[model samples]
Target: MARETHIEAYDGPAGGWGSAKSVGRYVLGEGAPLRTTAALAKQNKVGGFACVSCAWSKPRDPNTFEFCENGAKATAWELTSKAIDASFFARHTLRELEHWSDFALEDQGRLTEPLKYDAASDRYLPIAWEQAFAEIGAELNAIDPKAAVFYASGRASLETSYLYQLFARIYGTNNLPDSSNMCHESTSVALPESIGVPVGTVFLEDFETTDFIFFFGQNVGSNAPRMLHPLQEARKRGVPIITFNPLRERGLERFTNPQAPTEMLTGAETTISTQYCQVKAGGDLAALFGLAKALIALDDAAAESGGPAVLDHGFIAEHTHGFEAFAGACRARGWDAIERGAGLSRAALEQAAETYARSTAAIAVYGMGLTQHRTGVENVQMLANLLLLKGNIGRPGAGICPVRGHSNVQGQRTVGITEKTKLAPLDRLKELYDFEPPREDGMATVDACEGMVAGTVEAFVALGGNFLRAIPETGAMETAWRKLRLSVQIATKLNRSHVVHGRAAYLLPCLGRIEIDRQASGPQAVSVEDSSSHFHGSRALVDPVAATLKSELAIVAGLARATLLPNPKVDWEGWTADYAKVRDAIEATYPKVFPGFNARLDTPGGFPKPIAAREREWTTPTGKANFIFPESLDENPDMPAPNPDALRLITLRSNDQFNTTIYGFDDRFRGVDGTRMVVFMNAADIARLGFADAGTVTMTTAADDALREVAGFRIVAYDIPEGCCAAYYPECNPLIPLWHHAKGSKVPAAKAIPVTLRAAG
Candidate 1:
């Protein structure tokens, strides 16, 4: 049954009673009141499991109520009372369930036991874990090692990720495509080339000392609610907060800390953004160039007047290279081009530049909006360039922060969840496990999709993500996945991917992070690295939803034992039994970074991993941070001019959702309720396109070679840029071509799609 649609301007501040009410609804909806409360209490606690939401780091001394609204929803969703058993599968056929919405499919609840698709009945029948493992092993053994694609989700812990990569390498395949290939691969690619590391240098404490903070393309309220506390504190401290985004996000506009009883009870809210600049959907690079250009002009004028220079000349001379060429490129970018490309006036950018110039210390934060574009890598590098101009890196209260989604995603990469095979990690693995790791590069997420379409990929295995729904061009990807000879999904809940089966499909139910993991040795705690690179131990407080549900480590071990013939001398069972053993192995593999892994876990607040870039010790080829100068502002430099009638479309996430998981249809922050198929358009654009404010429309991609369209989208007039529009993803994912991705990063350019709107037939 569809709920009634409601649209109104949201006047309430973020993170107040609204968040509390949403969290309360989710907790009650889970149906196990006591258990849900207990489980939530255990989340983000000192010794309890980390929240499975965003990777925002927990406070050193976290309050009793440490979880946020999104975190609460994730917890409730995972620990829900509902269950999907063999009988539930028998009630519905694969074809019948295929038409269900992504939310409906997952809301069927936790998978209680292992299931295997029965082609005859077109249903998922119960299967023993051993039988499923044997079948998967047989299919894997039958195929060439290179034909198998092992996909990893960021939700997997460091231990599970390490074991997964080991299993893939032992099976003689380097095709390890992961969620990072779709999200922060741009940061992973660009940061290392520009600086010396792939990770951000900022710590949680950095927010306190910053004089100015700039947020680009990040909506802190929905993505990471915990971040609002610091931003609120920064506001109280009189720090200038600048925001650059296509849409006006409420979290960036103002916030009310629910934790503050006085503010929540009294209705007082903290003003967040001192200045908000609505940059065009693919225009971050141009805007950044404009900011840099304005800064350069101010510096030149200062130098001519024999006044204090705006640029950090000392930092540039000592810590960076290619400044001369980069500066020249920035200065050469004309104001007209910048204004046209960024959809911002020259005065607004200059005002932002002036605010940035006056600050002694500043931090630049960004999210998927900047990274999910054709120039995603360049967009990130440009942020780095902006920071480097005033020596933002390697200092307190200042650095580049690509606020990553998914807890432990960064940790997974830290523990070697990558398609590229580095010799150092390989050698370390060999020294620790006595196995020769593959040297060749593996397929990324896009490459794996292409491989599946080409019929070169034989098998597919996912650790914990909804692969089919998360990827771009869902129509093509769904078909490609079905063509595989074998597909395996190890997850807690049933999703769209489970119904869209391959020749032989297995659904292996695994324990969620909040559930206790009891192994042969003893109870174990898995470690995860937060976005800030702090590693902490997580132990579940609640029992598994079903006794049959296996831990991710156990499943990986079972697959390894069943598949890898004549196994090496490594003790997979021992490592799985005691996660401390896994930590020991991690220490052995990466001695310098993870030194004394077990010992470090004992330290309160966990140990912050050493970042060479933070210490200004650049290990880049130039032995210093390299400044990159792009030839053009356009993400696709060779692309044809955009259609005059076409609007730039960006896929967004509702406040009620995270990634592909929809908790509800409401996007309270944006004042959208009861629908996921609505598109946000400027009032002027709506008027120009001859559509009413709330008119229904069909959005069709303007791609020359491919025609991708989605119908029945309600157009909601919003305070957005004139020629730009926004829609929630997975629903809008069909319009983004798989081939339209960032250069070098291969991340889908979901935020820069060109689309034309027509009245619904």
Candidate 2:
């Protein structure tokens, strides 16, 4: 079935709405509408449920949707009243479920009964909560503590995250493989090195005041729909937004907000970016370096004219270190190198730099697109260096914003789900639970995959995630996970992981955040922090689909009780009955940081956590901000000299998709429809390959030993640079080698993949 890239036809924009509405219907199985609902019943109250979409904070203002398109989808998914009990499981075997599409499988709705995978039946059978807990404990107790690994998702609540960390520490292992290790690890590794803060310094208000916004490697419209409104507003205010991405995203060009009444009435859309530059995949580093070099030259010229220099010499000298080294590196790089590497001319780069210099405040917002490269950490540091020349960090309307994926991904890490870094929380846990926490470092996401591939890990407890499919090196991870003795998953619905069975696998159904958990102690509220570092309460608004479904807190407690430390000093039962007790433990653990956790929840907007960037505090060794020069801007290896036979391939997501989940087969913005298997290439590339437009094509892995092939793909002409092509991820994921990952974070280089195109059979 090996085939070349081909084009069937274009599916119109309005056509996809039907599909979107269809997915919406599937997600909102059975939920009634209600007005005058309490704060907890409303979607986005400080005391209500957190938006299941982007990490953008909701203002106290009631006008905004508080929910984006994706947020609405997330909320609908959570509020769905569909049920998946033992009867549903009996009707579908694990093997059969394995054959289902990701959307169809998740669409089957919420889990109800605690179930274990039956080898003979190849289906999950219902088990009592007590038995499930006993089995988990017995399995963990039999295995070496070092062999057990804890996998966490970003969807976990703050209380659950804290307790999970404590449980792992007391259990004598620090193998916390969290979602952060996959997405923003580069930001975590680089920001501290450059500007003294790992998170964004700009609050939502900063977006309103910034003069120019430089968005590098982010698709804000689809990824964070809330960003579109602000960006549109900025556009209307005549603020320039220069976008540098490998692909010319449709959302970046224009957006018609469905929420805006005027636009909807007139069928009008607001234009977003003033200038769009399509850099080569992995060429972001080069583009950034080129811009900085241009700015430095501008500064020198401005100084000669007796005008204020384009650079903030005072800020650089007072707040930062290593400016000299970075300056030297920029000065040494020639214009030819910059032009060739960045795929942009000196004039184009200067125009971009001049925009930065002229603006009162310039904010650079990025997404996983920046953090998923080989030199991702260095890339982020370079971005910081560019901003520092103009004093962008810790300013009124400027800073670096990393758009985190998953609603509470950042919050999950903030509370405690880290592998090795322990704040004063350990002592508090000791006092509250009478057990010493582990001090050793734990495995990161990359290390976990490596461990599984090496077969040292014998057990994995996945707390709500699609670990195997979500991770890279699917083949290697599957091989290693199959060697494990047990794998336990606490989830609200079915996913690929349940079918990727371990020797002893259990799928423990848990309650969603929107459901009411009426336990022994009465109703409870869970704490969730947003990306902006504001912690608030989440109370269940809807009743659980079935009475048997348990909360994650309850499930973890039952397992802990059944397994190690039968007489554990921690109030596991109390925390399960009421999550506030768990928050009390969190507050006690970090008094200076999380003091008055309960009292603060009553505030209008939850209290802000400590942000070093806000106060311009440097937590580094020198007590001053630092800057380091990356070796080069060429994030990708040099291409083979004038090889007409080779083509560079980058993976992308369709408008109808998010990560591995395909809502439908239409990408409305890209003028694509009814398909996920299309590749975009420049006209010259298609002509050079001797392929006709809209013809069938095949993509084969660049590596000689690899046999991965994506067939029946349609080739379409795009505004892309010559010799570069793009396709959807996971479908093309087989072409990405496990060994090809970022140097610092080890995340897969999905943005820069090498592949060869062929004519289809």
Candidate 3:
């Protein structure tokens, strides 16, 4: 059964009565409103668990209710009154459950115990924990470690991620890939080459003192809702905000902070952006070039007039290299190419450059919009080039900010969760843990999928994620998944991944972020780093929803204990008894980043991890920040005779969605309701496609050998560029080829898939 879509215009400002009503409905709809209400009060505070939504850092001085509507929905969804046990599984077979929607599967509630898939009856039967672990460990030890893919989601804490990596390495493999591979792997890979640090330089305090803000790709209202508060404040202080996105997102245009009583009561709103540029999809690089070109031209004019220098020549000469080459490339880029690639006029880019020149300090913040392209790595480097032109990296109110999606996605990487060998401390692990860590470079997300499809990979072990839904080419991967020797899913709630099992699959229930995690010694709090590199302590105040649920830390240790032989070198049992041991091991592994790991949590907003570029000390190959030039304008890969009918399709997330989890059907700010299968196209594009006010249509992927087609999707007229169209992700993931990804980083290029649309029968 498909969801029927109803299209309408939504003129309301972001975060007003609309958000308030949504929060009320979501929180109350959880079947336990009173209990969920009590738990909501403790979210994002000093004493309570962190919001399991976006990676935005909690304020130093948090209000009574610091969580947003999306945060509330996440909490209520976790602490729901509904329950699912072996009885529920007994009632529904695997064939019957496969037909259920993602939302319906979640609505069935949390997993209670260990269950093993029975192929004979096509059902999952309750199994003993020891038997489950013994069988999984036997299978794991039986296979080549390189052939096993150990995947981690962002929802896990630093303690869990650290131990998870340690377990994988000790088991003799560096095949550790996480959710970051799909999202900001470009930032992690590109920033180090440009500025000598993978993390962002701008902190929350910078938001207060910034003179201007440049926002790109991400929709702040839906993705990082709490960011709207700072944007609103900056707007009130007269700090001009420039937004460059294909969609004139309601959050960028106007925002009414729901936390502000005066604004909420009076129905008043604040204008967020002083200017909005709807650049076409796959055009961020060209738009960035246009801005840089205008700035260079301004500097030329300033030199002729004997005026103050527009470019920071002094800083450029002292701390940066490759400026001349980068500048020459920008100069070589013609305005016609820029206009065609960026979908904006030269005058508009100049106007933006003028505003950028006027500001003493500015922060360039972007989201997945810039990262999920074939030129994703270059797109990030281009932003660094723009910021370096003004010496913005190590300044008071200027830097680059990449807004992360999950709560501790950044922290997980800091402690250890990556496929690349450079980030992991191989030398230290050998000295500290007395084991030979994997030396070879490991496989990323796409590599893992390719391995599975090629029959090179024999097992898949996931720690908290819907692997089946989150990745590209879902159908192909689903089929490849069955070929595995074993599939182990460590999760809290049951997702489609649990149902789509291998020869032998086991589901292990784990603790959620909102529930209390008490180890053998005492209650424990885990550390998580924010997008700005600040680490905070997260302690759950509410009780566990189920009696059988174990902490992720314990679960990881349990599997490690079962898999590895009785090795005196590692103490899996001791680490599970106390999480502090995990932190100690993490500090020892990366002493530079986590020197005072446990003690730093007492600080007001937690301690800031050291970033070399933040101090203007470049640790790059040249010992200086380098300006890299983009090889092309459009992010699209080189193709002979490009498809004339192709429209760049940007897969989006509904306001009610977080990753693959859908909280509800309404996309409030986007005027979308009742469906996630609609396509957003410009009014002129609708006419060009020979449709009147748009009708039901089918989309076919224009690239790759695969016959990728999604049928019965309606088209909605949006304020996007003529050649661009939009649709929700995971739904449209099948259309994107697994081979399509960022050039150097290998992140999935979901934002710039070339597609064609035709009327559906």
Best by lDDT: 1
**Candidate 2 local lDDT, 1-761, one digit each (tens):** 22232234332222124324643553444353231123123666755676655676655453344555556666666556566878987788877777776667777778888999888998889888898899889999998888889988888888888878777777878898777777787888888777666677777778889999998888765677667777887888989999888778877887776566776657576778888888887778888889988999888888899988889888888888888888888988888988887787888888998888898798898877778777888888888888888888888888888888776777777767777554325666667777776777778777877777788888999888788777766766777878889999999878888877798999998888877878787888887776667777777777777888888888877777777675456778888877778888888777766889987864544567787876777777777777776787667553334345767777776766666655556565676766677889989988877997788898876644656676888888887877688888667776776666677767777777667888998
Which structure is stronger by TM-score: 1 or 2? Answer: 1
Give me the overall lDDT of model 3.
0.88
User: Which pairs clash inside model 1?
Assistant: none
- Give the alpha-carbon lDDT of every model: 0.89, 0.75, 0.88
Candidate 3 per-residue C-alpha lDDT over 1-761 given as tens digits, one digit per residue, 9 for 90 to 100:
66677678899998999999999999878887887888788777776778887888788887678888888899888888877898898799988888887888888788888889999988888888878888899999999999999999898999999889988989988898889999999999999999999989998889999998999898998898888888888898999899999998898888887788998899899999898999999899999999999999999899999998899998899999999999999999999999999999998899999999888888999999999999999999999999999899899888999999898999888876888888988888789878888899888999999999999999999999899999998889999998999999998787888888899999999888888888888888887888888888888877888888888888888899899867786878888888788788888888888888887764666678998887999999999999997778979865425677779999999999999888878998888888877899999889877875658999999886679899978888888998999999889999989989999988999998999988888
Winner by lDDT between candidate 3 and candidate 1: 1
Error of 2 at 363 (Å): 1.3
- Model 1 quality (TM-score): 0.99
Q: Model 3 residue 588 lDDT?
A: 80
TM-score versus the correct structure, for each prediction: 0.99, 0.93, 0.98
**Given candidate 2, what's the lDDT at residue 407?**
66
Give per-residue CA lDDT, model 1, range 1-761, as digits (tens): 76899999888889889999999988898887788788777677677779998899877878678888999999999989899999998899999999998889888899999999999999999999999888899999999999999998898999999999989998888898888999999999999999989989999899989999999999998999888888889999999999999999999998888888898889898999999999998889889999999999999999999999999999999999999999999888899999999999999999999999999889999998889999999999999999999999999999988898898899988888889886238877777777778889989999998898899998999999898988988888888888899999999888898899898999999999988899977788888888888988888888888999999999999999899876556788788778889888888888888988887774556679899988999989999998985788886564557888899999999999998899988899999989998999999989888999888999988876787999999989898899899999889988988889999999999998999999988
How does residue 406 of candidate 2 score in lDDT?
A: 71
